[model samples]
Target: MNRRRRQWALKKNLLRAAVLSFAVSCASNAAFADDEHRGRDDDHSGRHPKVEHVLLVSFDGLHEQDVARCIASNACPNIALLAKAGTTYTNAHTPGLSDSFPGLAALVTGGTPKTAGLFYDVSYDRTLYAPSDTSCTGLQGWNVVFDETTGIDAMNGGALTHLDGGGGFNPQAIPHAKIDGVCKPVYPHDYLKTNTVFEVIKQKLPGARTAWADKHAWGYDWLNGPSGRGVDDLMRTEINSTDPATGTDYTDVYSHTEKFDDLHVQAIINQIDGKDSKGDATVGVPTLLGTNFQTLSVAQKAPVAKGGGYLDASFTPGPQVSAAIGYLDTSLGRMVAELKQRGLYRSTAIIVTSKHGQSPADHTKLVKNGDTLSKLLESNNYFDASGNFGQANTKSGSLNDGTGLTGTGFIQTDDVGLVWLRDQKQLAAAVKTLKDNLSCNAPGICADGPGAYILYGAPLRARFGNPAEGRTPDIIVQPNPGVIYTTSTKKDAEHGGNAPDDNHLGLVVFVPGAPGAGERVRDRVETTQVAPTILQMLGLAPKLLKAVVSEGTQPLPGCEERRF
Candidate 1:
């Protein structure tokens, strides 16, 4: 075929696919709306034919390429087994912003950051107040309450209640927010603005049990939202918890974090056995049980001797990386075995994905630079005298004593950087300043700079939402591929960016007795489809989630969209 003809054909095919997808979504939505009006008489929608339980697991920092390579090499046999019995979306992706807060929100809330309102864990909100601001009393807009080094435990609300120390929320532990006109400590679950699939299940299918375990006490809280804890049982074992176990101190979620993840695995097994981890009958067999694994991500960054030493971005799994994959597969294998033993395997739908993929999959591309962005802005007097930026509190003390940024902006630097300018009018000048220093030293700009791709003006608003949207950052700085904004020795890799490895994630859906078992679909999809898919599998309306309707989320293409 001639070049013009081929191009025309491709465009025609693309348009056809888009139209088909849209048609399916509209039809599904209409069917769901009708069912909602008809009440729960036909509760068993039969959309998910054989599926009764849904298991969602995330391997943080897993890339689609890595999954194919690992499974091909037989390093991830359990995952390979799942792929053989399920459909694998080779081109699965996370929504543009790759932060875990927003990434997981897409899966559980069925929306992207635009609808979920979660840019990053430490993003800015224009309408929210700094803790020290007298206008809102003690309410802080930014979610800076996740630091574990600040003498707060990562789980049980930093105390005895599994969320708190038993007395109630620790005033000094959590970020304070004024809810319903009362200023109180902000629990981790309060950060999300949307409803989770768990909440939907609890509301729609009252007797259905749901449980989830995650690296941080608040990791799974992104889904629970403001409904106050949605999961029937939530296990919070801090990945960075130093609380010793098995004669080892938990470092991060990568190195010695397997023990912590194992606890969650055991909990899953117990939950499948129709009980909680403690052998208590508190949480009956959960209809939805899930947890995220971090071992592989850790292995990808560790030194050669420790099991991860990829030569480059080729995604060649080193011993550590390969071992991490094997370990994760084994962990998953255990859960599958338990389900089978209990005769629940055939009735379960398994979803495996990642919150974000690690960047520089080739460790050779890892670059460590100081916070040059902050240094440049601070040196230019862009910050307050104390250089507090807008931070009202740190591990040291509360900045609310009024010593922090009174008129200065805030800077969150990582693989991605968010700059919230206190003076919105200075945005033009700031953008110019950042653009000028994109390479190296330029005039007043310092030396040894990786520069940045500034996201502001029309382009920024076009990609992300409007800056005036409260939580949206005034200026976004996505550093070059190898340039991480911090010099922290803690990790050799980081996510949360537009990098190929950061957004392209592994996705597999396994439903036993389904005709598509062992089939691989090359369709490019997003994790946001996961929530609605799970809801459909559970025989519930996907639009029951507000974000699903608002964002127009669609179920996975191959699934049957039956009307309940």
Candidate 2:
């Protein structure tokens, strides 16, 4: 095996060993559960109270700076209230590759992309075969697989057939994966090889109730992992839904998304009242329930003329940003009000965070270089002739119509780009081309503008994993902060890159009676730590998550003393 491959194999073995050991230890502890206590505080400090439920709220594209800006302006009073009663981590970051799937997975799975195997919502996997050559237009290489769906679902993994399975509008769906040798349809959860906090809770506390509502139904399936279905209550909503009232689709825009998020907020309120949002009382109250808000993300990308904030790092939220933040705070306040009304507020823990933050919040820095990298490689005969001329299966709506690439190997690009060459020998030529054409003198040569960086070799291997691992990209091109690889004039910003704004997120943990209320931790913390910390708060073994076991991921610092 090559050196990189050998290193990966070694790490994989060591990880397995570590996981085995942790599992054994947890099992042993379980045997003595009654003798001591499980998820119960052994500390007599009086400050540590029993934590019954954990409500995790993820705000997509919420930057720490955005929170700071909004809070200073009193736009996000609810979030500020939580921060005042808990520990806020100002230096929190998402695991590298700041996309929604991996970003949230890092929080709920307690592992980086390296351990969780969730690179991005739309990532390349060489080992897996495309459902059919006629579908993605490719057989196995560089296909966009987000849990049985394609990159076409920019909302990322809602059920294909319906919006929240609601009968309001016609269904816009993506093709289900058809792996050559695998019988199962490749749902988004299948792409995630690790266990999530929900799965861990089910295994350790079989009666624990769990629920989640997010952008797309399928993308958040990572909560269930390969178990197919695990969340007791799953509220599937499509942010891309068109208004049945006006027949207008607000797919990526914030104003319309806010309406949809309101549905989730109502669901949370109902869940707190011991009823399902669908009015199913048999479902019972969830011990863990939450949803992500997309309004801020929409505001970040909306044009100023359209009443949106500047999508830059300045953190000066404009009218739209200000309004979005206020709306979100109101939604949060509703949840809090319901919890209090139900008398559950005193026993529940609240966690506010973001799956990923958007980059280039400043509009002036926005650069829309129309897929220059793909054009550069396509001209070099790097892509197959079929499938949108070698671009990702994103633009061509045929992703569900069964007219994708007929072969494998292509370049996938957005705000971030990944290059998967057809042959191993082409690596050198590919690198040379990118390096040589990196000059910003021309419009297309280095599309990254001034300070874009190419990540490969050791740096890529360290943060991700060995490129030979099938899922890891051969080359990763992170364009300048504001450089989006699309020519679409609608979008003002994007995420899924290593830029500071994309990686940094706001994180605050609030346990009603926990000791650290009103405290702040300025230390650098990864989103992965949130999973184990939540597990710890619930009096469950943190090692239940494979990443916690494999990576020695711990709960938030100063959390152990407050855990019950």
Top candidate when judged by TM-score against the true structure: 2
Total backbone clashes of candidate 2, pairs 3 or more residues apart or in separate chains: 18
lDDT string, candidate 2, 190-303, tens digits: 767788888777777767888888876555666787675657777767665456754654455677878878888988988888888666686667878888888888887776
Q: What does candidate 1's lDDT look like per residue over 1-564, in tens digits?
A: 699999999999887775443111211211222323444322245453456788999988788988899888888878887887677888888887788878888888888877787877655665544444433664344434433322243222232223221223223434445557765545556767778999888888868888888766543455566788678787655555454343434544354767767888898899989998556675578888898887887776565444564656678877777777778889999998787677776577888999998876767666666777777766655554356654444434453222333234577766777777766777888777777677633332222344336778788776667877656778887777766676676667777776677889999888654565566778888889899988887768788988889778888877646322
Q: Score each candidate by Cα lDDT.
A: 0.68, 0.70
Which regions of candidate 1 fall more than 4 Å away from where they truly are? 1-49, 130-143, 147-169, 176-185, 218-220, 245-249, 252-255, 303-309, 390-408, 440-452, 560-564
